[model samples]
Target chain A: MKYCFGVDIGGTTVKMGLFQIDGVLLEKWEIPSHTENEGAAILPDVAASIEELCEKKKIAKDQIEGVGIGVPAPVTEVGIVQNTANLGWGYKEVKKEMEELTGLKVRLGNDANVAALGEMWLGAGKGEKNIVMVTLGTGVGGGVILEGHPLVGTNGAGGEIGHICVNETETETCGCGKKGCLEQYASATGIARLAALRLEKDAKSSLLRSQEHVDAKAVFDALKAQDEIAEEIVEEFGKYLGHALANIAVVVDPAVIVIGGGVSKAGEILLDYIVKNYRANAFFANQDVQFKLAELGNDAGICGAAKLILD
Target chain B: MKYCFGVDIGGTTVKMGLFQIDGVLLEKWEIPSHTENEGAAILPDVAASIEELCEKKKIAKDQIEGVGIGVPAPVTEVGIVQNTANLGWGYKEVKKEMEELTGLKVRLGNDANVAALGEMWLGAGKGEKNIVMVTLGTGVGGGVILEGHPLVGTNGAGGEIGHICVNETETETCGCGKKGCLEQYASATGIARLAALRLEKDAKSSLLRSQEHVDAKAVFDALKAQDEIAEEIVEEFGKYLGHALANIAVVVDPAVIVIGGGVSKAGEILLDYIVKNYRANAFFANQDVQFKLAELGNDAGICGAAKLILD
Candidate 1:
């Protein structure tokens, strides 16, 4: 009945959880990250909070095997956060510093990779050996797990699927400064942008007049209402998503691709479109691959981080 | 002193090679494949040739450890050439048939994957654990090796880089029945098409007058002569190549990418352009990943097939 701690560090909040070796989450909680000033200077507060939590639960330090932390940036081979664009943290030895304060071995990985690990180990992809998880939020992010191990690549920056080009025409720019990246047209922002562009074209749509501000959710709502422009946007977005996934399938060829994050809440509307287009775009032989929505959702990060320590 | 045999089965030729355990090529030869008529009937000929080659070389049957074959198409999990576009073969159990006839163990893989294995083990990608090999020929084919092993997906159809979509605008139709695939614009034929399209708009080029028939090489020659149209066409072609490579880098993050085949003969003119644009298009952290021409050239298939058995 050995246990471990998993911590998911985010820009606005930090999620933490306790898990047994068998992967059952015993407890979990969230706290403000307060990353405004210099970022990561709040380590002492995090350590103290964890210590207090353990004390209150009557858990001994010896009972916990290790700690795993998922950060929102690339990690060095030795567990240093190279740079977190969202958190505004730069090149810090997170594992060493945290381990010294908490008196436990620490493992660190990219937050997206960790979340994929969680899904691979215990969620939708539990029985699957090969998986590629794409998180479709404000921006798209991805992590690939091949044969049950995360592909960290040479520089530990592997699995940046959002930046992969889906459109070669250079019609849109991505946050990474590249044009025609998949993230520019398939992410939540991408959906919003497409919807806005349709509105600008003076396309007739009842949904456009019903919403004060158009976002990805509004696009999904319009799709629910069967709006032509919304249907076209979703279909086109799904085509790009499918094309990108098909390309990834040709490279990694995972048994299942788990779609996660805020935009994924659109559920079958998005997935149905993606699957149709994915089948049409994928290599003739890879048509049988499955697409599943991530089951763990927000808790996947903590669970995956915890699994890292358990593994 | 253990040795193995490797065979590369192409549309027109069958390349066979012998190699030692330490990645050294001992002997090699090529034979007409004659795959146009009922391809499975050619297996006996391949087996007889192997026996004759061994006998002529005074190599004992017992000294040969195994045989590996690289086929130019999708293979089943058990080493069957399911279907080959170039060879016109369908559902042939090559490995089992070859092993039964030759009295040696046999392994089969896709030709592109085998070439990547060859580069990873004995050529430009030597000593690297992760590599992606792209062959720019009539079409742009690719293979990805992650963590030192070839990526053979569920359907043995992984590494189909040629089918990846580079354009979402649906400007060009690919041979694979898809629109805007990377190969439609990056391969030798793709380059020739671009050259022809440019010639139609800018007919003042010396390239059009210098050659009776315009092709990829003619375009390269014109670029060397500082023809504006040729340079523009080359630059555009290079941009697409770089963009595709950058997209691949983001997903796989291989330590080095090896480019091979006839179009690669453009050498520095192509390499320099691809490198410059790849850096500009790639994510910041991936800018340092190496891109080089494959070292083995035509022998890659034979050597890689042999190395597959050794590995």
Candidate 2:
């Protein structure tokens, strides 16, 4: 049986998985990311880890297909990364270096994009080729898959859904230095910001006012108890997210929208509000788009990274 | 030299073209569309014309590549058109029928999409493979081409840019049974509607008030003459179109946006207002997207239809 390695490189950890050609995971492990010295050791470390794993498993080099990597930065189709601030790398030739170090073919994709591919392959979007996956983490991330391939545009900027301007009139700036980005209203932090804004707007209180640190988890927990203020905050968050997805549907018309990330831990309850707003704003022809929760969670990165080589 | 046939079936006429495999238009002509009898005669007519041309030119079947068709309706990847209200067709197997009739390989695409492809091949987006083309005619129609292929969605609803909800708070309903659609403000008729609304909001002394019919042309002509009310209407139009495009860019990250259709007759002046608002609301990474006017006018359909076969 042929084998392949999937690697997800984040700021702190390098997650790796060995999988059968047909997608069955044989083993998975991690290594701490050595990002000092411009992340010069990161590729070397990854290559050494793969070599060590192969030696321990007694797998021949010819048995392995290649290595697929998902990086925490925008990656060009050719495997060049312009800026990986999180990984302490600047304009690195990731694919070339990795291939040279391990003498294995390498494929690279953006983390969020590969995660979406994972979902499409074996997670919530399984069996569906066209899907839009939104990750509502500390910051919102998006990955668009069309016909089983990620929609990686000319400059690797496709599926930058978090930066979509949902509210054009807002004065507040987003982390991208843009005003009224979807990330400013629909991310995990954005949800807490909504709760904060709601609390600041009115004295109506019950659960949130009692919390010292209000976050997306707290907001959902409070709403589960039928908190009126939490309800409003969720509604506003749903409007921004759902409306943005509706707009996205107009462009790509994905069969399903998979919601993941930290905020999605709120469970299926989150989809209720989001689906309601999505239907209310979606184009007539696209009103029936299915909404599903991402199932792979953290493992999505590795699985999706593996998919990169298979594709 | 191998030859191909490009047929663009419109509501009133069917424009047919004979092209060399290299994309040179050898000959072109038109035939009246018989939309009566549920448009049953349309495909048969298209086939007969192509067969007659081959016979007249003494071209054998071996010398022909295939035929590409552009229909005025949503088309699935397999070339099934769910509804063609203008052509009086419903639930038609366009590709199968055409292939049977002509005994040649057949390819079908949406008219707007093929027009965008035509522009990409030889018009404004000549060298670009990723492009979003918006046709601002009686209505706003869009075609998104990625890596030189039209993005045909699950149910053929992809690239329906006109129906995106740009203004969620709008009370007036759009033609698509939605409220606040971009088409309500960005189409040619939408521009006239904006002019009407602007004139009605205040008794502003403007050149539009004197016109019997204040259409998009009147608004642009008045703006050129430095009419204040006309400028306001154009600004509103530009805001809707430009902002909607910015949202689209975040989803697909196209290299260029090609503007076409009837309203583009206003020339470079139209690009000014649109570019201004687009820069104001676009994501930081996508602020440099190029905007160009479509170079192929009515012939875009035929050229793009021809390209469908080539692809």
Candidate 3:
């Protein structure tokens, strides 16, 4: 049986997994990324971890067809991480360096793109040929899978959906210095921020009584209680999400759209509103597309990385 | 020499052209399209025109390898035009009907998509594989070319950039019944509306003196006279255009972006501002993509339809 290794290199942790060509996960593990270290310092530790896993599993080196790495950075088509704002790395040939260390063929892709690939390959979009996955965590991130392959553009920066402009009135400032980016309103932080602003306006909500510091979960709880302000915020959030998805539908027309991340934990409450508004706002002809919740949760990274080689 | 016939079917007219394998135009003609007539009624006139062209050029029918038609409507992958808004046709098999009339192979595509194909094959996007072409006419229309082919989604609704939501606050209404779409600010009518709104604010500008009624060209002319309000309007217009393009750049990261249509005639004065703002607003890694003015002008429709077979 052919096997491959998939590594998802995040800012703080690196998730690694072993899998067969059919996408069954055999084993998985994690390691501290220590991303602060220079390029040379990080490779030896990564190599050591891989070698330890191979020995413990009694897996032959020849059985491993190739390794696929998902880095939290913008990569060139040829596998160089051009620049990662979170990691502070610039123009690093990650694939070549990892290949040298592990003595195996390696391919690298952006983290969002890889996660999207993972969802398409083994998760909610198992049989889908076209899918768009949005992760609404601390920040908004997305990946586009078109025709059963990741839509990696000229420089591998193609699927940066968070940066897409969601507002034109210059209301909120994004980390990238742009105002009114989608990430400013749709991510976990954005939702919490909206809740806080509502609180400042003296909007009555059950959320303030239970939690000293409000978060996205608090907002969800308040929504369930039918807090007028929380419901309004949720509605607005859903509208933006639906509007963005509708536009994306025009560009990609994917068969399925999977929503993941901390805010997505609200489940049907969030999805119901998104679907209601998406159908109403989408171009008249595209009201029939499907929207679903991503099933893999956090394991999406490892599974996606593993599936890269198979794809 | 091998040749192919490209027909661009519009509401009022049909533009036809013959193209050689080397992407050169061999012959071209146009005919009135009384689209109110049934699809069957329009067939013989198109056939007669093609026969007359062949006779005039002394070219044998066998020399034409195939015929490609670009219709102003949503098309399925199988060449059926599904309810074109302008043509008022419902579920018509354009390729099959044209093939029966002309006794040749036929391929059908959306008009905007075919125009992008034309630009990719023989215009500004020559030699580039990934491109996005936006036509800023009365309403915004877009085409996306990825990996050298027009990206026609499953429902054939891909490349609908005009409908992408650029505003979250819902300040403007779009013709598509959406709020704050990119078309509300970037298209010819959108610019004229902006200029008229500025005039209402009692802003001082030569644009007021340039024309009896405000239009996109009048705004450009006023900007040339260094009118403060016109320059500000142009600047604001540029920002919106830049914001939309930046979002598009993040999603597709095309090698080149071709801007066409009536508003594009504003030339460098408009392009310089858009390019500068786009660079500032784009995701950090995608700063190197090129933006160019489309060169094919009005011939894009026929040429694009022609190049579909060659591509």
lDDT against the true structure, each candidate = 0.84, 0.93, 0.82
For B139-170, candidate 3 gives per-residue lDDT tens digits of 99999988888888767888888987766566
Candidate 3 displacement at residue B242 in angstroms:
2.8
Candidate 1 per-residue C-alpha lDDT over A1-311 given as tens digits, one digit per residue, 9 for 90 to 100? 78888899998888999888788888999888878776755566668878988998888889889888999888866898777777767778898999999998899989989999999988989988789999999999899987677778878878999988776566656788778888888889988888888788875855766788889998898889888888988988998898889878877778999999999999877899999989878876667889999999899999889878866
Residue-level lDDT tens digits of model 1 in B42-72: 6777789888988888888888888888988
Best by DockQ: 2
Off by over 4 Å in 3: A1-4, A31-65, A85-90, A97-105, A168-172, A203-205, B34-36, B41-65, B97-105, B167-173, B200-213, B227-229, B276-281, B286-288
DockQ of 1: 0.58
- Report the lDDT tens digits of candidate 2 across residue range B1-311: 99998899999999999999887899999999999999999999999999999999999988888999999998988889989979989899999999999999999999989999999987999989999999999999999999999998887878999999899788889998999999999999999888888899988799999999999999999999999999999999999888999889988989999999999999999999999999988887788999999999998999899999998
Question: Candidate 3 clashing pairs?
Answer: none
Q: How close is candidate 1 to the true structure, as a TM-score?
A: 0.86
